[model samples]
Target: MKIDATLHYALIFRDMTTEIEASKLVNRLAYEDSLTGIANRTYFIQELENALLEKRSIGVLLLDLNGFKQINDQFGHISGDEVLKTVAMLLTKSFPTPHFAARLGGDEFVVLLDGITRQSQLDESIGFIKTKEKNFSVLLGEQSVPVEFSVGGAYRENGDTIDELLMRADEQMYKEKYKDRPHERNSFN
Candidate 1:
């Protein structure tokens, strides 16, 4: 009778541990992007909000791939997914820890760089991206698919909210995304 009671208790503990692990896996899947294996948009926004609440000086970067639709149309989604993964890899390698990158579905990605207390820091990041912007290319069959992107960076203003910072960075990104192509993405039918 004693051994049976002990065995029952051990089974109960095992089941409890399994439940805890399952819950943790579910929580992680909720915030992780399936394709690129980076933080999804929801998680990224939460982190940004947390940073703002902590009053951390941060540089918000919005990156939009230019002509992404064309790439998908020409190379199918496999090539597109490959390009997206490549972009995520570069962002992770470029930023490292504390600084994070997230995918906003489709071809849009966002990066948050903390500890940008000076204008020089922002400028240096801009320079780095400008230098590396042309280096993203993927070999797709016989043709090499070039991954072109436009980046916008904005520093937090006094009493600025996350939405405002995102808007500013997005506007800056659009400026570059539509620099020469006045046709734009939405009305290019």
Candidate 2:
């Protein structure tokens, strides 16, 4: 009887351990960005949904690298990937913990800032990102290449849906891209 009880307890413990491990794996897959180890788009959307449901005011920033395709075409896909990783690192460092950042795929990233109450604070945060310099170098064979991004954002009050917020941010991002084209061309020369 004693041996049976011991075996039963051991089996229960093993089952519990396995359950915990599986839960952790699911959470990791759901939340982590497979490429850069930042949060993924699913995680970002979940958080944004929660914030909106709770009637929270927030700011969403969408960033797309200008001339990213040029880098991929001129250097190669590997170089493009390195530039993306470096940009992700810069974004994670720039934003705070309560604020979430994620790569929305390709060269575009999204940042969601919760509990924002004022336009000035939002402006300050946007200004901070605009001034950040991504100075990382990617090695293509024996050569080093540099890259940068253009960012734009939109603020949400209490009732905006995810699609609406993303659309506004994307539109603003396109405007910034167009505005920077002159300087972008100049920099290549």
Candidate 3:
């Protein structure tokens, strides 16, 4: 009886340790961004893949900062970093819940919209981003400068990979840039 009790306790301890380790792994993957603190490309891709595999219709918005080179040229790389951070903050605030946002790299950001069953919800989200209040200021020498973004979005369909979806969204973003706008650029500039 004593031997059986000892074995039972040992098994339970091992199981508990395994559970704790698994939990830690998940938390690490979910919370930490591989590149930036916003979110890692893997996390974004996993979320997108889950949504797609679940047959849940969703929207992907890819945003690239136009005139980012101008900011870097005029101010410096530090100012460019400020712009990326500010834009990341804006994206986090804009799509507060139910939407996953991440920085793919450099000046490119992507948003994955889950629980979007209707086209109107997608439209509303797009409109919200379009008219979103972005009042970020950067100190350039002695003066403060402001910046804005031109965004584009695409809906996810069947038979789509992560790259395909992002490319499609990027294409839409570039199309939006082509429209006559003050803050718009020709491409992912």
Candidate 4:
């Protein structure tokens, strides 16, 4: 039997397309958070390392959710899951494209933006983060559980190591977390 070349080519293309879609699905599952649907820690770290290797100017922002444990204890794990999902969506919306946002497990999340060495861009991103308090809450059962987060950010410095940047951001986050202290509010500067 003689095969029609056009039909054979079309069949091959259809099979290729199916394989491509399946591969994409697998990638998403591997790299995405099952609950919040954001990138997982592995993907986030990979991106950060890639940025560092490429010598790109970037800023790393870390956020630690406050009262999350209390909420989980008082409410339920399901409520906590809802809060995480909500916060993930908010970060995704706030830092769309060229900027990366990921859930680094539990209540810790990170946002990476390129060109943060530029003062205007850095200020704008930081301003948006600081002003996002109004959008961080989630509804749990009948009560509204406010999802509060403290943010710490560090810009890439010349010859800075990944660990240093992470530590700086983490330290800033700690200060933010303890902003109730008289001297903690301005510690990041």
- The model with the greatest lDDT is 1
Q: Compose the digit string of candidate 4's lDDT tens values, residues 1-189.
A: 348654443333334888899999999998998889889998998989889888899998898888888988999898888888888898889899999799999999999888888656765776788789766567788877677788888888888888998998898888778868757546674
Ranking of models by TM-score? 1, 4, 2, 3
Name the candidate, 1 or 3, with the larger TM-score value: 1
lDDT-superior candidate, 2 or 3: 2
Per-residue error for 164 in candidate 2, Å, reads 1.6
Error of 1 at 30 (Å): 1.1
> Which candidate leads the pack in TM-score?
1
CA lDDT scores, all candidates in order? 0.85, 0.80, 0.75, 0.84
Q: For candidate 3, lDDT tens digit of each residue in 84-139?
A: 87778888988878887898777888888876666677677777877763555656
Q: TM-scores, in order shown? A: 0.87, 0.80, 0.73, 0.82
Q: Per-residue lDDT tens digits of candidate 2, residues 13-72?
A: 335888899999999888988787788898988988888888788988888887799999
Provide C-alpha RMSD values for all models, in order: 3.9, 5.2, 4.9, 5.5
Candidate 2 regions exceeding 4 Å error are: 1-12, 15-18, 134-144, 180-189
Measured with C-alpha atoms, the lDDT of residue 7 in candidate 4 is 40
For candidate 4, give the lDDT.
0.84
- The TM-score obtained by model 1 is 0.87
